[model samples]
Target: MNELIRLVYASKAAFRAVPVTQGVEPSVARILMQSRRNNSQVNIGGVLYFGDGYFFQALEGDRKVVNQAYQRIAADPRHREVTILSLKTVPDRLFADWSMKYVPVEQAVRAFVRDRGYLRFEPLQFQEEEAEALIKLFHQQRSGEAPDIEKKSGWFGLRALLPRKFGGSAGR
Candidate 1:
């Protein structure tokens, strides 16, 4: 039986910033292309968000396939400090219409981040509530609604605020 599941992960981009050509970074564009091809082939669906040298992605598919895909991603050298934020069985796919939807952070979301006390888009410092909010924001964006970034007063890399036993590092 095909056990559907959802796996969310975050990682830091290992490569230096390259100027975005045509509104998409060359490296990120390449990743998106590859993801679309591979994911479509395997019947996987998901969304990917990139900003400020970090990646936040949610992949949904069969249990085995999703695990295999996560393993493959963990092995990828392009990502560092790969972390699995959430992994759970689900009754249906949230992004069934997309093979691999790539959602860019909108200005509103950037502002939202600022409002949330995060000066930049660093996924490493995201708390569980923050992660869930981001996921919901991405879903809203996918649904054609504009997502807003919360503006708070704080900087990034404040690991002390993180959960003691939150998501575990996956790829290391």
Candidate 2:
């Protein structure tokens, strides 16, 4: 069976990373390698940003596999206060090639703006359809259920933001 295409986004945890048996950076790298080597993922892809003692990352792949990856990731002594950013269906796989890859924000921001246009990238907000998908993703994340991402809902979701609790006041 062909794996379903999906995307999972998370804005670094608030508190602190989970208990890392290893040190810090080395332990993180080790966990990433382990995940790539022995993970049940279809095509995990995303970025990890380090700022304000928080780590924001997005992982995309098969719904089941991706969800499992999140749980495992949380267990790591490298992240905490996990607040999922978004997880929705995309006609295309964001990163179908790599099992796991780093997203250089400086480079990715430029690319995202270029591909999505200045307005699309700005506070421009999601289109009616995208809003619904994002909302569904948020709900799924909170309830710990598979995203109803593919379905279309209403528009109020555009204002439905993830609680500030997920993001602690740290970064500038």
Candidate 3:
């Protein structure tokens, strides 16, 4: 049986400038469009969050494919200090429907985090459970669903919801 892997990473954006208009930065939009096309071809699924010169991404798919994609991303000069927070085998994919879901630092989400005592969308400071919850929050928001932040068990509880297959340690 083929094993699936989920890899999460945090990085500092090489470019910190924001667009003058109300939309995604042109460069980021281009990247997202290209990534969506490429990832779909390879069966990759993931979510990307960008805010305050930082980037937090969670990628899930076949082990080898995900690793290769990570390598390409690491080589991209747009990202600095790229660090993998977690890379472990899982029984299922979390962002299965999205090839590359992009979440920018919007006022609503910023307010949500601030209300929760978070200064920013910094996934590096989050535990595994918190990170999962954040991803679920973005997913819910994108789907136009009213997210219940108090219900932290939404996606974080997947570990308990499904059986584990491969026993592998998370990467640094």
Candidate 4:
């Protein structure tokens, strides 16, 4: 059987706000478009959540390919303080159908944060488990699955902005 791996990570946006681009499209939108194409070519799949100057991404694919892709992400100037939250070999991908799913900062997520006493979705303030939970929550919401936000066990703490994980080093 082919080996599959899941890599989860987060990072802070280098810019304080989404920067305007030369074209009609916003920079973030261009990034999403480019990423979707690139990820598809490499057979990578994942979900990306951007909010409050932060990013939480989960990449799943062949171990080596995922690692290579992550290297490029870490080196990208748009991302700062990239940190890995989890790197595990899962039986299957949680986001296999998506090349790069971008989760918008919608009302449901805002409500979830406010109800939890968080002023915003500042991932840097979240602990490892909380980061993972947030990623799962967004993924569920994007996939039209009902997330059990009432499960209090999964949310807590904030440390750094970006969470990233892969089998190899960033420079590789």
Candidate 5:
């Protein structure tokens, strides 16, 4: 088996930001749903943060699997200027329970950005220390089950907004 590894990357959104409803943008929701499905199948776990037209994601899993996944992400049309921030072997997964945990850019992160002299969330400008701090914050967050779209009737509304290629269903 390949050694467990963690890979962090940042990317700028290629698509326009959709209005956020139910605390997440439509495009992001689609991405999160797909991630949950794909990662779970490959025994990968990760945390994703989306804000201010940028994405900072940390994926942990077998080294080969994680690298394959990163290659797919780098070629995704929805992302531009994708750049790896960190990649290294690790003893274990930090987000073991989450196939793909979505971490909203909450207050603590906002303060962290301001403290670093950034007016908005911009992971591309982050140095190694800032990136590591963000990962630490991700570790501190409690892991929750990925939202059950079928059970949460409220999410059904989001299905309509998804592209037809994705089957317009959460995690389909």
Candidate 6:
């Protein structure tokens, strides 16, 4: 029997800004493809979103393998900062193994920041449409449901609001 568990792992990861400037998008793509390939061997489904020099990925699989992969990703210098928002285990499968994904934040979402207003997205209050879409995606593993995730906030990194002296900064 294929044992499955659902997880809504919310992660905030910031990458080295230099790589993006150096036209490292190809390398990043390569890394993503390779990660997905390797994951297939271990029965894992990894999906990710990117924007503002950061990445947020959701993965589901065997507990041991998933845990190890998470450790590796956290250690990867390409993305030094990682803040896991929530980790919950569900009774059913949330994703199909061997499935990996990506979404351009802007293209995948509806609302964007305007004039630095905090009125864009709220935290943990995904509207009915978004909530339904998310549950669908989680249950089916592939349903154009994103920018929805962007609607929720509270995604503060412990190291994003302060200076290096404060150990909380997301800028260079």
Model 4 spans with C-alpha error above 4 angstroms: 18-25, 114-117, 143-172
Candidates 3 and 4, the one with greater TM-score: 3
**lDDT of the candidates, in the order given:** 0.77, 0.45, 0.74, 0.71, 0.83, 0.51
Using lDDT as the measure, the top candidate is 5
Clashing pairs in 6: 159-168, 159-169, 162-168
C-alpha RMSD values across all candidates: 16.4, 18.2, 13.1, 15.5, 8.8, 16.9
Which is superior by TM-score, 1 or 4?
1
- On TM-score, the leading prediction is 5
Q: How close is candidate 1 to the true structure, as a TM-score?
A: 0.76
TM-score of each: 0.76, 0.46, 0.73, 0.70, 0.80, 0.55
- Tens digit of lDDT per residue, candidate 3, span 60-86? 999999999999998899988888887
Q: Residue-wise lDDT of candidate 5 within 67-123, one digit each (tens)?
A: 999999899999999988888788988877678888775687899899989998889
Residue-wise C-alpha lDDT for candidate 2, range 16-86, written one tens digit per residue? 44454433455445655675565324446543333334444556566777777787776765555555545
Clashes of 4: 14
Q: Write the per-residue lDDT of candidate 6 for residues 5-81, one digit (tens) a residue.
A: 43333323444434454333664677677776787677777566555555556667766677777787777766654
In TM-score terms, candidate 2 sits at 0.46
Question: What's the distance in Å from true for residue 172, model 4?
Answer: 51
Evaluate residue 151 in candidate 6 and report its C-alpha lDDT on the 0 to 100 scale.
Answer: 23
Location of the lowest summed lDDT over 10 successive residues in candidate 5: 143-152
Measured with C-alpha atoms, the lDDT of residue 134 in candidate 4 is 70
Once fitted onto the true fold, the runs of candidate 6 whose alpha carbons sit more than 4 angstroms away are: 1-24, 110-172
Q: Select the stronger candidate by lDDT from 1 and 6.
A: 1
Clashing residue pairs found in predicted model 5: none
Q: Write the per-residue lDDT of candidate 1 for residues 29-66, one digit (tens) a residue.
A: 89988987898789897888888788899999999998
